[model samples]
Target: MNQWLIVPVAIPAMIAAVLVLAMRTSMTTQRAISVAATAAQLAAAIGLFVLASDGESRAYFLGHWPAPFGIVLVLDRLSATMLLLTSVVASGVVLAAIREWDTRGRHFHALFQFQLLGINGAFLTGDVFNLFVFFEVLLIASYGLMLHGGGPRRLKAGFHYVAINLIGSTVFLFAVGTIYAVTGTLNMADLAVKVPQVAAGNEALLSAGALLLFTVFAIKSAMVPLHWWLAPTYGSTSPAAAALFALMTKVGAYSIIRVYTLIFGADAGALAGIAQPWILTLAVVTLIMGTIGVLAARSLPDLICYSLIASMGTLLIAVGLASAEGLAAALYYAVQSTVTSSALFLLAGLIARGGEGRAPPLPHGTLVIGLYFLLAIASVGMPPLAGFLGKLLILDAARTSAHIAVAWSAILITSLLLILGFARFGIQTFWNRPRSDGAAVQPLPFALTAVIAGMVAALAALSVFAGPMMDNMTAMAEQLIATQGYIRAVLPPAATAGLVGG
Candidate 1:
């Protein structure tokens, strides 16, 4: 009723556009607007979460047209949860960047706001074309954000980032074009209804389209084979930029769940015989590859980046299993990983500051060492943490679905690789003595530490209340897998209310 969905996406865009003009006159005002805009978006997201928990899903049809003919914005449980997570993490990173903000830059605040606008837009939009538009919007802003300070390394990374994404965009466009060709619509809700009606033989075309689309998403999500770009690009970027990039990949993973479950779920014959099975296979490979990357990487940022790859793999496994519980596990872990991985990267930045312009070498001081151990334990899914709960749910889901071999193997292999990876890094950095000429250990910023601490606390809270959280996530996952709930939420009252309830 409140139309709060629009605020999270549109308010930032409006503020960013105005800031572009105001930036030339008042840098302080621009900074204030940027911070305030993010904070407001965070509040709006929380409101949406409350609405979602009450079983309210809102849909806005652009230009006053109804679904199937016009673009729409739909917010259900999944979207609401993702929006809240994105807002919280984005706010933390933006706040952390306060010390690093460049008041003199022409587009600093403008780009940051626009980047957030794109992210929120992606999370809220109900149309496929709009997703592409938001992705580009985010990427264009990211290009600037990555090179904001204009160093050689940043420039190099930006070039690869832009080039790879340009290719991804092309693939994305091709996939969308094919989907529209077959379904005659780009609205995801509409496509969800129309895609199953496609001819059997033409199913090949749909599969091809889905595969192409998945490829683009896998690249963005940093799935193993397509993940080469992430470490170098993210590793070279500034800490604030890297923190933002950390969450951006989840957008891709989220799309994977959204599209596969909503539009492709009805085509179980096709998906089960080909797409889902292949995805499951890839998930295993991705998990192994990512873990190896972590074990071998010497740099802390690179290790964190590879750890992100591992998390992405874990999510893929859940999605590939295609059960309600599996999806809930994926969603739960997705949130946990986003929070923990970002915190780890921020901590790495803090540690690096204490080094010779690199991540603090292994064997850090006692205080730093303890924190690293805690983070490593969390990242690798040690018991009594949110990560462990998510992993346990995933294993249970896999086992219940009768994929016992894959389930047990995934659990065992992932646990071993994660533990070993972290152990190697922990020993190298914290347990070993500091290098003789390494930079003096600068006091980590309280803001950064506070964020990490908050993430840890959230992880612990989620674990403590795992039962309720799992129940909610299970409900959300059931609705998502059914697709009817989302479609009903997006359609006009006459079309959906009687069928799905208002």
Candidate 2:
């Protein structure tokens, strides 16, 4: 077992514990510790990604315990990529938060670190039960973070967020329970071996379990009908907290790719293609709703929230295809969407901080408007940014699918709507806005500005290196479709002998 596999989770857990115990009263100390810890986590995640890119799958068994019997953490290209995404987004959000949000409430740093611990753990865990555990951990921390700013709006939104996720969590447990009841194993690798061997009579029950599990992920991903909670919850939270949450939807997307591909993919006999049609129909609806939401948005934060929904809809188009090309494209879009959405969230906070009612013209009017234009272009899938490339990949991948016309038309039309809508927003909020009456023109925090700018620069770099990035995503997608290497790495040969014998 490689030691580096656990570093992403362990480092954050340790740092969070220290902050809670020793530095809760020291905002400066908490900020310094958090920044250093996130930077280190980013380093670890990058190292894991490099190793995974070499096409080898690695699994770490806790306390030297073997798979199906003990806790296991696996690092493959997809999971590694998610880890890297989380760490990078976290670093920027932490910097933005430390400027002011961190000092506004108790244990902000501690909760933030714990949140990372849950997210990283979710990415690495190999068992369904532990995935649920990590989900709870992250949710608990998020509950605290959502309420950190202490406004009536924040409290109201936080309550809804908590209630909805609690319900989702309950559903998740039931899904896991159903899976375990039928498969007799919760370890994902073990499930890959056991699912195909399920008795013919039990196939329906197993499929139900899988679909139930997907519903939990869909809610987390904010799929329509299940997506209504997102805009209000995210729109009302403090900017830094909401920005950090930009990666949360990807966690749901990631889980769908992992579980769906590994356990219920083409190799799973009766279960193969069970979810394809459902996902496709749901994805189209999701896309439409996202566009509608954007058109209806009353404020900048609300617009970005709708844009995130649209982005997730775009990502699911690839997932619905359930092919190597489709999954690869989805993965690419996932990265681009996560980073861009987070940057927009932070930028929105900077533009108008305290209340969402209206932003008095910012002191750095030119800079704020400039950043808004860049983010708007990037988020709406304009050319030369990663968002454009992401949509192109999805479009190209969708061309061979039966729904090509629908996918192309929806994406293109929505892109236009988004551009028009954002243009209107830009005019009202920045160009034609009334100046603040007697308001102080405080300069934007240097750290906050630098972090947002860095995110934009990173987006540019991703575009410049699109070819190599897509190549890696293609490999990761191939790995996802082929589960043999992943299963072999987690379970012993004898444990899978029955699966192979079949």
Predicted structure with the largest lDDT when compared to the true one: 2
Question: Looking at candidate 2, what is the lDDT of residue 423?
Answer: 88
Residue 212 displacement in candidate 2 (angstroms): 0.9
In model 1, the worst 10-residue window by lDDT is 356-365
Superposed Cα deviation of residue 371, candidate 1 (Å): 2.2
Report the C-alpha lDDT of model 1 over 407-464, residue by residue, as the tens digit. 6687678778889988888777654654635554455577766776777788888889
Q: How does residue 454 of candidate 1 score in lDDT?
A: 79
TM-score of each: 0.92, 0.97
Estimate every model's Cα lDDT from 0 to 1.
0.80, 0.88
The top-ranked prediction according to TM-score is 2
Model 2, 1-502: lDDT tens digits are: 3978989999989999999999867788888999999999999999999889889889999998989899899999999999999999999999888866887778988899999999999999998899999989988988898898789988888888899999999999889988998999999999988888899999989989999998999998999879998998889888898898888888888888888898888888888867778777788788889988988889888999999998898899889988899999999999989999999999888877634435455666688788889888888999888999999999999989888988899889999998988888887777666676656556678888888899998889889999999999999998888888889889998986655423
TM-score of 1: 0.92
Model 1 off-target regions past 4 Å?
A: 24-27, 101-106, 267-274, 356-364, 433-441, 493-502
